[model samples]
Target: MDNDPQAQTLIARFNKMKEKYEEVERFGRYHPDYSTIMKEVRVSKREMDMHETIAAYKIKETELQSFLDEISQIVAYSVSDKIMVPMDGALFKDGGCGCGSGGGCGCQAS
Candidate 1:
């Protein structure tokens, strides 16, 4: 998507419309151009989201985020103390990420 002309065009259009929307918003709801600019913003956003490559990328991004969140809960990767929290029951019983050597943060459970 980095070098795709269509993606770049769509992104530029969306960003331009978004900036316009923000500018109009500061002028309050009574601004005459507010409605028109808002519509443009919505259209550009929808156009970008409906693009095949962008849509697929977004879906994969969401899936990866969900997987990361689940991992964070099941392991101690996101914890301050590196203590693994039991998901359903428990993941590590050795305590403190279960990294037996105390080598680093996070669990080493295989």
Candidate 2:
């Protein structure tokens, strides 16, 4: 299939969002007492909402990726079953299907 510009853009946006979420996670991890941090940083309700949005986006992206991987497998197999098996399919960029040969694209499941 041709490279999808929109999908690529979404992937990039998701990566950036994931990075920002990681920063938030680190902040929370380092300072368990978030009330003090929240007061110091003046974190508003909207800021919390933004974080939640980011998290929801991450979940959506993961589900989308998994769906894409499964669809790719079906398409490939439809073209030629021997060309791609279910054991060779993965939903993430780096994961194994536990098959001996590692023929999959290495996409981890969602």
Candidate 3:
């Protein structure tokens, strides 16, 4: 979120960790501050991923991707009579829902 202060803070903190890691990355496996900074960077990344807005966005993004994939299959089925359809059948497959729209069709393909 462009205007989200908390997200901005986390991003800045993560960037700082990146810079610190760069300073110590040349050291071998036992670099003390490198591990600490890397751990902090990972934690910061997880925090961003778990943020409420970001988490919701990711869920919706996944659903949208599924819908898009279903549509792509549906389009191919329309042109191929199922010949070009992937083995991973969607509702567009025969005896399936025949509708890619997630409209609570109550069909098993859903």
- The CA lDDT at 98 in model 1 is 58
lDDT of 1 by residue, 1-107 (tens): 78678988999999999888888999968989988998898999999999988888888987786677578776675556567444432344344445665536656
Best prediction by TM-score? 1
**For residues 1-110, could you state the per-residue lDDT of candidate 3 as single tens digits?**
66778877777877787787777787845687766777877888788888876677778987887788788778888888534444343445544653654434645553
Worst 10 residues of 1 by lDDT: 85-94
Best by lDDT: 1
Point out where model 3 deviates above 4 Å: 15-33, 81-110
Give per-model TM-scores: 0.67, 0.36, 0.53
In terms of TM-score, how similar is model 3 to the real structure? Answer: 0.53
Segments in model 1 whose C-alpha atoms lie over 4 Å from true places: 76-110
Taking every candidate in turn, the Cα RMSD to the unseen true structure, in Å, is 11.1, 10.8, 9.7
Off by over 4 Å in 2: 1-50, 85-100, 103-110
Error at 63, model 2, angstroms: 0.7
In model 1, state the lDDT of residue 110.
68
**Shift in Å, residue 64, candidate 1:** 0.7
lDDT of 1: 0.76
Sort the candidates on lDDT, descending order. 1, 3, 2
Residue 90 of model 3 has an lDDT of 46
